[model samples]
Target: MQRKIYITIILFLGIVMNAQSGKVGIKTANPKETLDVNGVTYTNSLYLRNPGEPTMTGGSFLATSENALQLYDPNLESSGLFNYLKLSLTGISGAGVTDYDTKIDADKFLIVVHNYSFKMNDGTTNVALDYGDNGTNDNRQGSPDVVAFKSKGTWHIRARFTDSKLIALTSANPGRTYNNFTIDLYLMAYKRLITKQNINDITSDLGGTNGSSKTVNRPSGF
Candidate 1:
């Protein structure tokens, strides 16, 4: 029994001496960190917090102050939510409009026209679209000029003609019917309320001294 007690004291001294070197390893001979464990670890809860921070409990969560991680906070409105959609604008005629059900709230979303493609059902085939011409050339119909807006949870798209009457006189299809017109829209929807007019009216001046920072409230959406 005395020999066994001497062995336990020596083992405890060995562990203390190892820890005094600034790093202690569990199930490992050489440790690279303060508390390196070579084997698996189990714990009921894990938390990360700043030094001297108080422990949190009762449904509380850990959050970081890092800017890269703080850029997106799920607690705020989902302003970063993005959606892509393809819209078929069929039978675009002079002063004609097409309506589509977006299913996204009109007051809480923003839309941007990403790209467009046009097709002709008439005899004309393989006609390249001229993006620079805005209906000024009589020989060519030019790219379709249109305006898109959301109203009452629906998207309203309308065709704008520089001079529909003039194009009708020179176009092969005098009826001014543009068949198979399509557009790709990029939608950014937010769960909170935001208006198109409010975003449009914003003109923030971010110019200032270098490395200067300011604290401000989160935007309406985020």
Candidate 2:
């Protein structure tokens, strides 16, 4: 009887231990390229045929232009005007450090920027900002994860990572201890729209555009 009881306890403990363990999520900038997770790298067999082609299982559509590379659902529309394009290499690979039951912190990581350039039309310019935390909690605040530049004409845009570091966990599992690390990246872009009036103003001798007449319309039902 004691032997059976011991066996059951051992099995229960094993189950509990397994249940408490979790995995770290991995996200990549390019899905077609093999990603290195916890020092282990694996390539995706599926490839994207074109910008708007359907994505295979475990793969996603990545839009790359001279200015930027963006990941999107395969069902989304493609931008034919982009100068360059690439795939999104994002995923989860190994165990990551946990925070307060909400987030998992990535380990040390680096961002790689691709050099690209393009011609512009109408002398208009576009710009992108590429910035984010290096899996460190403190680095996330007020940082631009990614940026996109679009102007009237074609322009070259490059993507890259500028910094890295170690910080606190942003999220974690319940009742678990973690010292593990994973790399997480956030991408964002800001666009400044230029209008014909502004262009004229900038080129005007007075450095300002002529003011347009203002008119107000009253409610019709009143």
Candidate 3:
């Protein structure tokens, strides 16, 4: 009886070890689509911001602060797109300053800057800006599309506006003339390895199959 019990315990231990060592296939998908994980479906918008007063009226407005980097979820789900991340910004409204440009500047916007440096587990960082033509009707739309990077752990993303100005000369010095300007951002998460593999497979499939009707296996865990 003792021998039999020992054998049973060994068999159970082996099964547990194998289960722990199992591998999960990584996958990628358009963030707009619903993500189903472990028999549950999750759908929501992700927004990140630092704690600070809203943009000012005449003087420099503080859209986001350095220590205010935080994720806001209306639905409040358990799991989120924390690993694979994307950053996008859109100007909603603006006024005053003659020339306006937005880029991923590091020095001035210290608190609201996103990670652009290449490093392991940093995942990928992308940026886009929209600027209206000085004279022509054609407005420039900047879409630095999703850039992916690998991250071994969690990362922070943030952004803020700087170099606020006015076109006309004024001695009075308005309090916050750029009160009309407004900006919005969109954030997304994606697994790195799976994302890379997906792109490679897509290019290969396109070249080999010539856009033929084919179904590729989706990444298992993303």
Stretches of candidate 1 off by over 4 Å are 1-80, 94-103, 121-137, 140-144, 165-197, 201-222
lDDT of 2 by residue, 1-222 (tens): 999999788756654544444422233222232321333334455464454444565465455444344554334534321223332322211222121111111121111224222111222222121124333234233322233333333222222324422222333321222223223323222122111122211222433545444333443332
Q: 23-53 in candidate 3: lDDT tens per residue?
A: 2211322121232122322336544242233
C-alpha local distance difference test of each model: 0.48, 0.31, 0.31
C-alpha positional error of residue 150 in candidate 3 after TM-score superposition, expressed in Å: 7.0
Q: What is the lDDT of residue 178 in candidate 3?
A: 30
Better TM-score candidate (1, 3)? 1
Compare the candidates by TM-score and give the number of the best one. 1
Give a tens-digit lDDT track for model 1, residues 1-222.
999999788766756777999878766667766776776566666653442233343232223333222223456623344556666554443443445555655555556556554444342333333223344434544335655677776555544434332123335444333443333334334333223235433345556845357544556542
Native-referenced Cα lDDT, model 1: 0.48
Instruction: Please report the TM-score between candidate 3 and the true structure.
Output: 0.20
In model 3, which runs have C-alpha deviations exceeding 4 angstroms? 1-135, 144-152, 158-181, 185-222
